[model samples]
Target: MYVLEILWIVLFRFAPLPRIWAVCLIAINLGALFFLDTTYGLVALLAALTGIAVMMVIYSRLGFVRLLGIGHVFWIPMLIWFAASLPDRQTDPALYWWVVVLIGFNTVSLVIDAADVVRYLRGERAPHYRWRAT
Candidate 1:
């Protein structure tokens, strides 16, 4: 199932038409809500997971100037939901702090992804920082 999810995401990434991919993404999210089927959720979860994996590969070679930021954008929300869902020994808070955390992370991720995209568009071979650790 995981492998299949990965294949689906890779296919989406390479899809020629942005509209097709967007439609597929929306359909999956809507199906998850309408049918209460976790399969669609699971697929989305897999996509987020793959984003991290792909980021790792890119970062290893190019260093993390932007990809990490983009990842945070997507990841923060998921992290917040997961955190808020946890049972506490004392009491459950009315406000979901986890959701806030997720939002923060997502925003950071978006910034980084955008930076990388811009750099790539400008044909940048190297980032501001040294690719290798000091």
Candidate 2:
């Protein structure tokens, strides 16, 4: 399940799809959070909000490269937290699946963002498409 979610995000990122489709995907992903355990779901939501806050701060103050670096840095501990929570799979399969899906998305996004940061550092001017672009 987690593997499929990761593949979906990676494929969607590169596919020539309309922006609305990406928005739909995000909506679906967020909607799925309701099925998760309350505590776990709230934690995930907070983490996401924190990530957004961090991105806005970094992007507004330091620019894109710094935003990417800070975002990836923030994700590292979240990744670790998800990994540490893997044992919950035995006790609560549903919550476990939710965490796995979140981990997959975060990991893929981090990788893509890291690649872009490296490209920028290397002086590459290749255009990158973001899902949120207008």
**What is the lDDT of every predicted structure here?**
0.47, 0.57
lDDT of 1: 0.47
List ranges where model 1 is wrong by over 4 Å: 1-49, 64-91, 131-134
Residues 1-134, model 1: lDDT tens digits: 33344344445443466346435543433332432233324533554666657656666666534443344345445555555554342453322333333344445545556887777666765544443234
TM-score list, all predictions: 0.39, 0.57
Candidate 2 lDDT, 1-134, residue by residue in tens = 32233234335654556344445435534744685556556665666656656655655444334234344456567668768766367877876776687677667767767876777778764334333344
In Å, residue 103's CA in model 1 sits off its true spot by 1.1
Which 10 residues in a row give candidate 2 its minimum summed lDDT? 1-10
Clashes of 1: 8
Q: How accurate locally is residue 68 in candidate 1, as Cα lDDT from 0 to 100?
A: 38
